[model samples]
Target: MKNSKFAWLLSLLLVVALFLAACGGKEEGTKTTTETDKETTPEEEEAAVVDEEQVLNLIMTAEIPTMDSALATDAVGFDLLNNVNEGLYRLNQENVAVPAIAEGEPKVSEDGLVYTFTLRDANWSDGSPVTANDFEFAWKRAMNPDTGSEYGPYMMSGVIKNATEISEGKVEYTELGVKAIDEKTLEVTLEKPIPYFLSLMSFGTFLPQKEEFVTSQGENYAKNSEAVLYNGPFSLTAWDGTGLSWKLVKNDQYWDKDTVKLTEINYDVVKETATRVNLYTNGEKDRTSLDGEYAMQYAADPELLKELETSVFYFKYNQERTGEKTPLANVNIREAISKAFNKQDLVDVVLANGSVPANYLVPKEFSFDENASDFRDVNGDMATFNVEEAQAAWEKGKAELGVTELSIEILGGDTDLSKKMDEYFKSQLETNLPGLTVTLKEVPFNVRLDLDTNQDYEIQVAGWGPDFQDPYTFMNLWLTGGGNNQMSYSNPEYDKLVNSANNELALDPAARWQAMADAEKMLIDQDFGIGPIYQRGLMFLQKPYVKGIVAHPFGGDYSYKWTYIEGKN
Candidate 1:
């Protein structure tokens, strides 16, 4: 089977710097403004000059949860992880797979099941050699049931030999497919051939972990800047685990440190749009994301840039609540909720960006068939809005639940945009559906993620970005008992289709594509398990001098390795 050419399609993609999660901590105190070249005015535009300190000051909407690749779930963690860690391959400037820690491309078996990779001698930030044994330990740890890595079971299972059994605790971790043949060599055996395997290697979950460092820290691993070792272009600094400010400094010991031009990357979590804009205007920040009316106001600004991201934001319903089945478990109720909300109004009015309303899970232009037809187009929109139909479904669901009135809470982020949208959904759902009350529960990103993982919410607003270039990256999340399936909504037929597409029909391109299409239809149309919202478009305000930062559609969003300050001597 051949890999899809769509792997690098997101190279042209840019997005607003929306952190994938919420942070609860208080915002750091604003940096005191320094004297600027007052001879220039706002009209001059050039007044916002580069800091010239060789530092990239930026704003993050959320604080990073952890640096440990195995446990990090959201884009914020992966964004820092992608820069501070190295895997066998990394996404290049073109968004295509490129060699990183590996000496070169891996050797494949004639059967297409085995991969042998030779490692390049590299050192961790602490000057310790990165050995193939490090990778073997990391892979096994991820697969171990005790590790509790969401990505390990979701991605590796059904792909790597015995990975499913190991994750399910049915087999020893030693039975997992990866092996360290020598200090400089690694061999991996997959259950079957996966065309996007190389791209998957670029994800942080596949990055190596030093056994000695990992065991020594145990629960403290990756808790703060000093807790973990860096084996990539930068090392994190000044992060006290819960603080709102952190820095990424160039790793002088990195194998390719000579090529890293940016010596420091400073980050501060700024939740308010006005604050971010003020910082950028005052030359305290190099970039800031725009939303709501800000996006509309800056629409004509020369510095304004709109990014079409291949990500989907949706509402995932938790079916199994403690003591009783949630109202979401009722198919009619789920369908009603899906239709009651107005997606068009949400994006046009609240977001006010170039984002598109989505009636399905996967975003448009995310993947394509060998014939060049879009996967989303082939699947068609599974959920659509119709007030009359929604009312009818609501009535039917009320009768089924034997209730005259019902109320539920919606869990969401604490960011300004998140709160605004949360209120909108609350109003719409409550107003549109009679005899229903919707409450908003907004928490910091980490808290929301914890609630989601525990399945403690009735309904939650969630988003997903592809980890690799394939429909399966999104499809695999809902597989019967998959790790990312926090909703606990399951359909046997859907599982069958996904399993068959992944394993049995993997080599049959046409059949595999059909199977995925069928599975998605079942998940959305038949089950109504989750409600589709929209595809995000980030409005970016970037300094023209900021150069070489790679905008990726999936896995971490941006890469800082090749990023440099332009017009600098």
Candidate 2:
């Protein structure tokens, strides 16, 4: 009985020893598998450390009016077009005109009247080769009178050879001096030597459009994202004509797509200041413009950015609307309104975005003379605020119009900030200029643009940013019967001065500069065709991780070609 018990105990001990050995082997095998699974390759390790989605979300104060380059007249449309289409040149970080589609510098004629450009091998978004014919077609299409392109007639009329004649229906569009020498070469002849012609190439009015694509779309050309063909670093997407939101995706077919970093960019039009601020604070928006109280609140924020742009806002006095004369037609009345408003108060109290009161048509520190002196410094202030002067002018204007009281409507934007500013103008004008009843017409940005185009408003609050790095952009708007002269402002002296600046004075740098300065003075100080309000100053919040956003003083307001998302997961 003792031997039997001893054998049973030995058998139990052997079984226990086998179980412990099996458990130990299983644990060792599991650890070996885990270590192998954790092993990372070089590429995998780099990706793990640098994993970030290359997406950007931004805000726009107004919706884009149109995507068609030739038809776009506002900053929103132009800015969007700048990203989705490549011109012969594009403005760089320093506001310098850099070669975009053109290869290096152009071969210029001795008289500087001709420019021969050699295009680099490029492709449209459809993978078709971009030829010089595309440029010729786009340019001529703009100049076609039937196209009724505002910017086409305004930008090209005086610069390109036969542009004015073509726009005036005096000559065929083919007569305008732009030709495709070959598949990769283009020749452009100018009416005269334009000092800022190279910079003008970067303007939205000069972007290329594919002939086949544009023709195929017919009435729907450039009406939406799918209707347009992109040739730049980004392709516009998700825009449905008048939608409030849009997206820009990297164009794989772009010539320099390898250098593009951002995969996608999203844009939402948030007109309300509170909504824009909330979007920025909640990390929903990467950037937002701050105005009024928001501008003051974020004055000390680390992410706050301020830029004094070369844009000028003003009151456009319409002499006639729908074939009937308005009270603003009287020079004294225009001058009274011009000098009545307190521009300093408007900038300090309402804007508070570092904006400065502009007493002249051209903003300071923008255009430089041959001696590098600012145009504003040389010309000094004109038609500035003077309550007494304004009252006296108002009385004289009333007598001239044979009226005891006069009522006028002022058209402005429908945004919260615009409404506030317009109210301030109404109060100031009524308080300062007696017997003046002001009515405010608030409309969307696009509606305001249309009204201005149709000469359908009495007095409109308008603004102009430089299309190129020249004072002509601002000065030429008041030219007699100019395309942008929707106000019926006509002055022979102004036309003569501007024409001389671009023609007889083309070769004489000093004379051209002085002529432009003189024209600006006449328009503001003498004619009072437009009342200078303030120079634009932008204050916005930007994420620290959002990098390489190029803000330009001229052309498009911003460029996202070099922009990218970094240090954000």
Candidate 3:
């Protein structure tokens, strides 16, 4: 009996040992699985730690309105479109087209009218495949009269065959030049060979559109973040359609996204120059705008001074809005207004950002003439500052219209600085022209735009800088029936001059430049569609740690893409 009991105890011990061995094996397998799940290499661990404590905060001088690239026309629009979506080509700081979506520089057909681009299998922020049809759909829809797109004619006129005619009801939108050779290739044909054609592509009109989203959103298209898809370095979020404030977050699906280091970009819409300056001065912002009284104050600050050399500022008038502009309608009156407003005075006194006054459409330092100052004929006819001469011309304008009252309506920006300038202009106009009373109205940015485009107000004050390096960008607005030609000003001769310049003179750089300069003279020295105030200088106050920001004379068109905030703890 004792021997049997001892054998039973030994069997129990063996069984216990087997159970312990099974449990030990299970723990070992579990630990291996955990390690595999947590297996991040040192490089990846460092990347994950980026912005671990907080997001990088980037502040802009304006608010973002929409993420949809197809319809944006303002600076905010340009920023979002440039960052969140890319076209077949993109512009460098020099406004030169570089490959962004295409395999490389596009191949031009024998006719110079057709453009064939090979795609690089880009994906949307959502990881959806980007196809050639996207470009086709965007180009076609832009030309469709039903789309009511103002930029369509501005961008597609010469590039997309029949694009202008179709938008104007002469041809069907389907007849537009863009086509998809396949899912990976896009082809576009032009009405005429444009020398600045590639530059035009850098604008927002050439960016791709999702057909499904366009059809689904309709008027509300591009009105919100959720309604859009982006393939650029970032996806826009926290942005309203109104452009009051916004953010651009990294797009994980971008083909060349590995180089993008920004975690979040913050933009705030600030129209008041003083307010913008305060945001930067108070340490509340890493980067902010400078305008008006603060412009010169920051000019001496080396950090801000570097950016001020490259911006353009001008005054755009809504001619249709001015009812009794009969007197102001005279080309003499337009010229007089140009002469009466002492641009230098505004810059020296009103603008502290050290903005220089301008008398011409393009800046003296722009990319047109790199070897020399862009201000050729610095002794040109338009450079004279003759308030007394302007007074004499105003008298002639009054006599030509036979207006006894010589009344006019003027629209100005709603900001505090604009109000002050508007007041000064009012006093100056009354002081300069006898019997002329210029009624002043102040409106917000969007409403001001409506009044300008719809001709709701007369003599509205506005400004424009080029979207790219070409003068055609600014001059095209005055083309007959142009969406931007809020002034009912048109001349066949002027249109012919500009069109011919684009076609015949495009390849001849010197000749083309001369032609464009002549066209600018025709508008300013002739039709008087707009008043040149001051070519704006780019102004920003950023802490020294901010790096990789380059300013172009064209505008802030791509500064967002190339800029990086360094030491962003």
Candidate 4:
């Protein structure tokens, strides 16, 4: 009996030991599997961090309304379309016009009245061959009076043959200067020589559109990403009609795809400064613009960037709002309002950026004459602040307006900076001009533009950047019945000066400069057609890794074709 019990005990002990060894092996295998799942491969580790070289993130103050080249009137739309569409030429990193869809420089006639362009072998994003017919269709569509294109009539008038006539309903759209010689060749005849023709052709207004696609989309055209076709280095994506965010992805079909380093560009509309700053701090944004006190706060940041541009901001007093005959119609009231506010104080206190007080409409840097003198220097300051003079003018204007107490609404932008500046204007104008009551109306940028266009505001705080590199760019805005002249202010003498500058005096550079200078003086100093505020100073933050982005004075705001990110991973 004792031997039988000992045998059973030995067998039980051996079975228990075997079970323990099996369990140990299972645990070892389980630990190895878990570690394998947790560990990342080299490729996986690389993707865990942002690939800065392939992606760019940015913020804008407002949303782009439309990407259609013909209808785009704002800087945001122009900038967006400039990236997604290619013209005959494009502004390079140096902002010099360079061949884009064109094979090379256009063949020009001796008289400089005609240009012939040969299209390159290129395909749109839809894989359709880009031909000269596309250019012809797009140009005619822009010139067609029925298209209701504001820039087309303004840009081509007095430049392209019969363009002015077509715009004025005296001729057919087919009479416009642009024509397709063949599938590959484009011929353009000019009414006269335009010295800046090539640069003008590089603008968004000059980009080509496919006839069928544009017709098919019709009213829905350029409202979203799918509504438009792209022939540039990048193709727009993920843009819902009114969304705040969108993406620009690299176009593999682009002729210059090899040169495009950014695979994706992400843009978000962030109007609030605090939100923009927060995004930048969180590494969610690679760049953001700063204004007012934010400029001062970010001035100490190592990544801070400052760019003083040719754009100017001013106040436009509308004399044609529907409800009432405004006091702005009286010259004495306009003059009083123009001189009531201290521009230096506005720039120093409200702007706080590097922006300079603009006493004149045209900015100081560009518009040089044969003597190499700046136009602003020749005209000197057009408007200035003088409380005593303003009060005296206001008293005189009160009698002229037949109102002892004048209440006016100042229309302004909805941004925080815009509000601050508008408030400052109200305070100063009310304080300086006795018996004047000021009200404020702040709205979104697009709404403000519409209000300005309809002449539906009493006083508008407005801004304009150069569309081309000329003093005439600023001078032409206030021409009688001009497309961009939202204000009702008009002077026949001003019209005469601008016409002469663009016509007979065009060949005479010195005379043209003088004419523009005189016109500016008549518009601002003598007439007070608009109140000049400041030349904008942009303060922003750019990551050290970002490179090769170009900020142009004319055309679009930035050229990101060569932009790339580095050191992200």
**What digit string (tens of lDDT, one per residue) describes model 1 on residues 1-569?**
00111133221110100111110100011112233212344334332334455689989998887788888777788788878999999877777778899989999999978999999989999999999999999988987778878766665776678886886779998888999999999999987665556666776778999999999998899899999999999999999999999999999878888667789999999998889989998989999988898888887776665667777778998998665789999999999999998999999999987778988876687677778888888878778888888999999999999997999989999999999999999888888999999988999988988998889999999877766556766676787776567888899899898777666676677788788889888878878888989877778787766766777756667778877675434
Name the 10 consecutive residues with the lowest summed lDDT in model 1: 16-25
For candidate 2, write residues 1-569 as lDDT tens digits: 00000000011011101100000000000111222145556555345435668899998878888888878877787777778889998876555678999988899999978999999999999899899999999988988877778777676776788987887789998898899999899999987665556756776788888888889999999888999999998999999999999999999999888767789999999889999999999999999988899999988887877777767889999999899998999999999999998999899889988778999987776666667777777689999999999999999999999998999999999888999999999999999988889999999998988999899999898877765445665676778877568999999999999877766676676778788889998899999999999877778788866766777665566778877665566
Count of steric clashes across candidates, in order: 3, 0, 20, 0
Per-prediction TM-score to the true structure, in the order listed: 0.90, 0.90, 0.83, 0.90
Instruction: Arrange candidates by lDDT, descending.
Output: 2, 1, 4, 3
State the lDDT at 37 in candidate 4.
Answer: 38
Q: Write the per-residue lDDT of candidate 4 for residues 404-461, one digit (tens) a residue.
A: 9999999998887888998999999989888999999999877877887689998888
Q: Tell me which of candidates 2 and 3 scores higher on TM-score.
A: 2
Where does candidate 4 stray beyond 4 Å? 1-53
Q: Would you give me the overall lDDT of model 1?
A: 0.77
Kindly report which residue stretches of model 2 are placed more than 4 angstroms away from their true locations once superposed.
1-50
Better of 1 and 4 by lDDT: 1
**Candidate 1, which segments miss by more than 4 Å at Cα?**
1-52
Each prediction's whole-model lDDT (CA): 0.77, 0.78, 0.61, 0.76
Candidate 1: residue pairs that collide: 16-538, 22-445, 23-445
Model 3 is weakest, by summed lDDT over 10 consecutive residues, at: 19-28
